[model samples]
Target: MTQGLDQQHPQEHRDRAILETITQEGRSDYNLVELARLYIRYDNFPGARQIQQDLQAILAQWNLTVEELFTLTRAIHQQGQIYRRTKSGEDIQDWS
Candidate 1:
């Protein structure tokens, strides 16, 4: 039988504790997007309200506003990467 995450990885527990502390304090020296991704992934977990507040606080540190961020993300998804890996100037038909 597999054990729980806290039991299997003690370091993970310590890291989570540190993340919780930073989130509650609304501060992080790490990449804001990475930190925000973690919070977003656990949005339905305990202390969700605090997570939402922390996301807003972190976003304020970024140069782009919420709308601008969304717009840029949308553009990237729509336009794909700046460079293609294929030598042929045709879209790869078989994604599989």
Candidate 2:
């Protein structure tokens, strides 16, 4: 006769469950820069401006500059484009 065995550690099982939940819920970017870009790209100017205001509030909270925020926004936009292209299986041509 054969006996059944329990193989999963409690912590490992909990971690896997948590990860599955998060993956099913999808990715969320709470960063204002990314939120603003999403709004702007979709032609939601009012929403984008609202997010900009929120970004300003965050900047004030962290004592950061508008220039730094712009830089972050640019980087996020670049990464988004790359991600989109990759997801769509489109060839990205480098003209540099």
Candidate 3:
């Protein structure tokens, strides 16, 4: 009998473990879209919410406003947006 994804990870009992892997394991960092999918995979919406809050807190450390983070997140692509240049072909700067 096969178990589930939650049973696969060693730290399944630890709620923080999932978030920790996002940073420590580095494979699942940010990537909220991916994280959401992962949460769905594990059938863990509650855990997903916790992870979302944790990620938001981490990003808050950057002093980014909610609007800025919203713009940086690509909902259509379901991925994080990394801006290298503005629409005018200039490098992005002075983002707060």
Q: Which stretches of candidate 2 lie above 4 Å from their native place?
A: 1-30, 34-55, 81-96
lDDT of each: 0.47, 0.43, 0.45
Model 2 lDDT tens row, 1-96: 112332333233433343344335433332444433332342323233433344445457645575665666677667765333555687442211
**What lDDT is reached at residue 46 by model 1?**
39
TM-score of 3: 0.31
Per-residue lDDT of candidate 1, residues 1-96 (tens digit):
222321222233443554566556653233333354444454444343444455566567655466655555555546664334568675432211
Ranking by lDDT: 1, 3, 2
Best by TM-score: 1
Q: On residues 1-96, what C-alpha lDDT tens digit does candidate 3 reach at each position?
A: 222322343233454554566555543224443344334344433334455566566456545555554454455245534335778877452221
Backbone clash total, candidate 2: 0
Question: Against the hidden reference, what TM-scores do the models get?
Answer: 0.35, 0.31, 0.31
Candidate 3: stretches off by over 4 Å = 1-16, 25-53, 75-96
Write the candidate numbers in order of decreasing TM-score: 1, 2, 3
What lDDT score goes with residue 10 in model 2?
A: 27
Minimal lDDT window, size 10, model 2: 1-10
Report the number of clashing residue pairs per model. 0, 0, 0
lDDT winner, 1 or 3: 1
